[model samples]
Target: MEKADSCRRAAVEAVADVEPPRLYEYIESVLDRASMVPAALTLESAAAMSPEDYVFEDQDGRHCAGESETDRDRTQISEYDSERIVTHAAGVQLIYEGLRLTRSLAHDEPWTVADDDADEGDLAILAADILVARGFYLLARTDAAGKAVRTVQSFGRDQTRRAELEPETASAVGPDGADSAPDSLDANLEHDVLELAVRAGAVAVDETPSPQLLAVATDLADAAGTSFPPVTECLTDLEAKVREQSLEDSTTDRATSATDP
Candidate 1:
């Protein structure tokens, strides 16, 4: 819960600078309750990490700092770097939520829109677009930007595949459509977003996530499915999982190094 709270605060702050009052209000409302699992995971991974090895020399071949200043520089880098990573996580999560909502409206048709009274549906569409754009804005300068973009691309492709597999109407689509269950292609958004979360988190501290860590992300995504549960419920033992994966990765690295010529 604390992690979620931290994530929410950071996410809200990230979007607080939006110029439009109404759009900002809509974004804030969504962030007020959006699942923070992705962002939380970023923070958790960051917490468990140490800074990357200090650069001994600049690109110009000049020494950057001495041992006396190394710790201070690392601390400063870690502080700002974690913020950037978590912000990227928040951005990706927003994009995922927006896409999810758009998909729900398109495929599920949760509500009807009268020809003359399309305000509600229009607003929802606008909000979804805004959320995704803002999310992209947040990730634009971060290391995870490419990953975030790919996640959205994957979501779009999967949705196209979903439409082919399952038509617009549930009952009318029949047996062929019925195979596309909630946990099938529909759940891929959650799966990919969670993986991105861990990756973004690990990279913040200069760590490449082990396969085991990513597997944990998959397991967590499967548990939540497409319902988008609160991260507090979904990531309850995330810290332990991260720690375990860290130790496992360290051991693998040691074994590999020991075997090297």
Candidate 2:
């Protein structure tokens, strides 16, 4: 009984860690796989469309460039052009919206009942709910894959960190026990480096920047046609310092071991 309880608790905790589907991911999935529908047929097309051919005037009355001219100032319109333009492609957008709604309903559906064991009807409903959730999950996965490609293409290699700034004119002392001179160039460099680092997934706002992150930022900046030699030099110097510190630590550890009582 204790083992079973422990297993149940662990399973619940694991499920808790799985986040719900994001709106962007859900939309992307439906759009990518949705079947193409005719331009004339839309969300309302299914019911209204008939076998009889329908004649309609072009909304923009212009037959050709110079054919229709009420006046040079007055713009001619055509009746045929009156049809609502489906900018997002109606069929796919509608299906995606439906999927989003279904996913929401499935998530909110209740499984609780008076009895511990669910009845046949309740079980069937539960199964349906599970299926809906699974379908949404699959869609989210596909969307995420598409988004990853799109994001990479637009960002052109993510560099998310700002460059470190160097102090301009040095001062002897300031109120904060440091130099009072401003480092505008260093500040701008730091901003650029940070932006690149964030794009490259090297550093995050909540996380401390590391030497590797600095290196990545430098490379990204170079690719952007921006020279950041000072930052590169600083990173190199920092790496050397780290190596020296590590060597000193190892030497001290060896000495301590040899002299131990």
Compared with the true structure, all predictions reach lDDT values of 0.68, 0.29
Per-residue lDDT tens digits for candidate 2, residues 85-191, read 12111212232233333333333443454453334334434333332333233224332223223432332222121111112324355677644333222233333
Q: Pick the TM-score winner.
A: 1
Which segments of candidate 2 are over 4 A away from where they belong?
1-22, 38-40, 43-83, 87-92, 99-261
TM-score of structure candidate 1: 0.77
Summing lDDT over every window of 10 consecutive residues in candidate 2, give the lowest-scoring window: 38-47
Report the lDDT tens digits of candidate 1 across residue range 107-142. 755356575445556666777887788778877766
Query: Alpha carbon lDDT of residue 25, candidate 1?
Result: 81
Error of 2 at 39 (Å): 6.6
